[model samples]
Target: MMLLPDAEQLLANLTERMRSGVATDTAIVGIHTGGAWLAERLHHDLKLPLPLGTLDISFYRDDFDKIGLHAQVRPSDISFEVEGSHIILVDDVLYTGRTIRAALNELFDYGRPSSIRLAALIDRGGRELPIAPQYVGATLALPSDKMLALEKSSTGKLSLRLYDKNPMGHEQ
Candidate 1:
């Protein structure tokens, strides 16, 4: 079994980096369930002025046709003006880069931001696109058939879960 990364320590490192790195007009936006959770924590940790925003990129995904729709698709909410705002886009894992691409498309729909930075707790390398995270907690090389995910406990603690796909490409 793969050891889970230290969520609390990773957040501390990310916070330390953002202290000097974030611009004055920066806004935090999380990519969905897991990302939203992280953004909430980061926003509180950094004491950001702007409200934390969340994006549900279910509609903007390229593989929507093949995978169909998600059961719970929450509407994206960005209260602040995105124009000229610097955005910190948060995610639990960085894999194929498809999610970030979809997130970019959705984010632009709100308005154009001055810049956007990608942050992830884990970067499991298997990129099908040219996307890379600006801030990452750790990078791990996993087999193509294995998938990594973040799971939050009832008390709001975080852990990593690895699922292995069988020879037939079915998740175990």
Candidate 2:
């Protein structure tokens, strides 16, 4: 397996991208877990006007029937009005594109945003959908059998891991 980039380096790259394009009116929303964690940091670093928003897209997933429900499904939270607001949707990893698709559906449920720009820490290309990120911290290519995941320690340190996707599930 290839060495994963340091989380700090990836965050620095993401910070630079956001600093350049994001405007005052743009709101930040992160997809659950890793994405939310990344978004929280970005919101604080960028000093965005609105509070950080988090999304739990378990219910909105296209493969909900096949995968069933995830155990830790949290409610999607967006305190600010979404109508006509420019959105910066953040995620830790951009893989199959389904998560982003679900995130979009859940976001629209709250309200329609003027625009949504995708931001991701890593882009490992295995897209099943036509989704692409506007801002990417790092990009890597791996085989279909291997899965990349973000790990956040209790103390808030971030790391990455690789897993083998098996027929039953994942082998970590």
Candidate 3:
């Protein structure tokens, strides 16, 4: 099912939940692409203590050869201190958990934070690894043959849409 939320509502929900558990000095970090989109919104809404950090996990993926390099490779920016600081890792969607895994690897390369909490806009179940989002905008139980995609306009607007899979029972 397509259980998407309005961008404003999703932003409010995420900010509220993240503020509840996040330490006073917590930092916000977003995974590349979709995650970064959500993070930008949350950062503006929440007024986080530290500047936002954007990470590109494409180069850090274990299956890099299979997926190949993404067209865009944004640098992971966390110029501020990381050790002993609480971090909120943001992503657009949570599915197989491989992206989160790859994100963790990239995060460590910078510095080890005291703790890292996950935040996702949507959680579609199909976890290849044991990972969960600490804060979620919505949860959807989509059919295996369907796919969920998050898109953002150049103006920084965000939305989610569903696409039917091809004859091969995979997202086209």
Residue pairs that clash (backbone atoms under 3 angstroms), model 1: none
User: TM-score of predicted model 3?
Assistant: 0.87
Regarding TM-score, does 1 or 3 come out ahead? 1
Backbone clashes counted, model 3? 0
Using TM-score, rank the candidates from best to worst. 2, 1, 3
Candidate 1: minimum summed lDDT over ten consecutive residues — where?
Answer: 163-172
- lDDT scores for all predictions? 0.82, 0.87, 0.78
Highest lDDT among the candidates is held by which one?
2
**Cα RMSD, model 3:** 2.9
Q: What does candidate 1's lDDT look like per residue over 28-125, in tens digits?
A: 99988778888888888888899889999989888777667777899898998998889999998888898999999999998899899999888887
- Regions of model 3 farther than 4 Å from truth: 1-3, 164-172
Give per-residue CA lDDT, model 2, range 1-172, as digits (tens).
5888998789888999889898888899998888999999999999898878999888887876766777788988899999998999999989989889889998998988999999999999888889999999999888888877888988988888888776665211
Worst 10 residues of 2 by lDDT: 163-172
Q: Deviation in angstroms for 101 in model 3?
A: 0.5
